[model samples]
Target: MPVRYLIVDDEEPGRINLRLALADYPDWQLVAECDGNAAARAALARHDVDVIFLDVQMPGETGLVLARELACLCEPPLIVFVTAFSAHAVDAFEVHALDYLLKPLDDTRLAHAVERAAAMLRQRQREAYGAALRDYAVAGAAPYPERIGVRSVGRIEQVVVDEILWMEAAGNYVELHLPARTVLHRITLNRLEALLDPARFLRVHRGAIVRRDQIASLATGGEGSHRLALRCGGVVPVSGSYLAALKAAMAF
Candidate 1:
């Protein structure tokens, strides 16, 4: 199967150049292109992109800030920072699924990054499968994972589960949202739900699970649903499918 990719750069020339370079690899497909961080995020929401070739410098939101936000995505795309910046910026990317290519991306370097991304994506699939099996086998397993592991930059980061404000599903992974950081964990929401304390966390939507105490307000969301406003100012959508559970939790 061809790997779907996204290109995000403020400069039309940069986007064009990347497009031309990517054409050499027939196995990779360009699914979308965005001019800024907001556009890139919107594109991601509308399409399933496996990799993102991003520019670090832009007018409004820089690529580094966008990368941090992307890190929180459930199944974040492989982020390749296509920038002219020096190696110092490498530190910021070290905590997420990322690669860096100095300005004027080379075919050889791009090929190497693509190869590594393929291996990472494959490993992610295996991890998701194993997680589902483990979840099915354990009915009431205690002692859940103390630290959730997430890939960042070029290393694995362990995030404390207790600090997570909520979790949301994104494709094959889970987004663990914290007060200060969002970690993209390579695990299914179903598999993760089993490990959390039921009393503290509640499934508010098929794609979302939030800490009970973290909810700030629950209001009619229109269309027979509820919108849970969090203390952090992020609102989570609650579908009718989970309305009963959400209401019951609020009553507690």
Candidate 2:
């Protein structure tokens, strides 16, 4: 398969430059060209991109924020930061970007980054195949996963389902709140909800989902406002649309 990629840059010239530079590598294919983070997010959901030639600065969301959120993907696309400002080079590497290329793009540097992305992408493919094999070995017993893998930089962390207290929808990502910390997973709230066992997790609001056992109290206020007080000392809004279902789920 060709190495699919997306070019995300606010400037048209930058996007064109990267697109033309990629012509040298016939193995890499351009899936889409996005002008900002929002468009990139939408494109990502629609395609199986293997690499991203991303700009560091943009109008709203910076490339760093997008990269951090992408870390949750089982196989994150290789990131090659393309920007004029060399100041962000450190920040780019912190997010485990494959390489950083300064603008007025050099042919030699761009070629090197492309090679690096190709190498990393192949490694991830091998790892994913192995993971699928492992999952298949025990998939018959439980249709829903007991633990989820969260990828970051060079490592993959296993998060137990029972340890998740709640989840919040953040753009194209889902924030998994655990006892010790919160993890950003590169998936929509609805998609994540579908993967979890319904008996253990309940959607309390359009943007929130909570573990059934963590509901400490249902606080009601004026104007039909409702809130869920959790045992972990956190509160989540309870939308009226889901109120009746919440009550029934709690057996009250």
Candidate 1 runs further than 4 Å off: 94-97, 125-252
Residue runs of model 2 more than 4 Å from their true location after superposition: 1-133, 153-155
The TM-score of candidate 1 is 0.49
Alpha-carbon lDDT, every model: 0.72, 0.75
Report the number of the highest-lDDT candidate: 2
lDDT of residue 45 for candidate 1: 84
Across 3-68, the per-residue lDDT of candidate 1 in tens digits comes to 899999999999998999989889899998899999988988899888888898999898867766
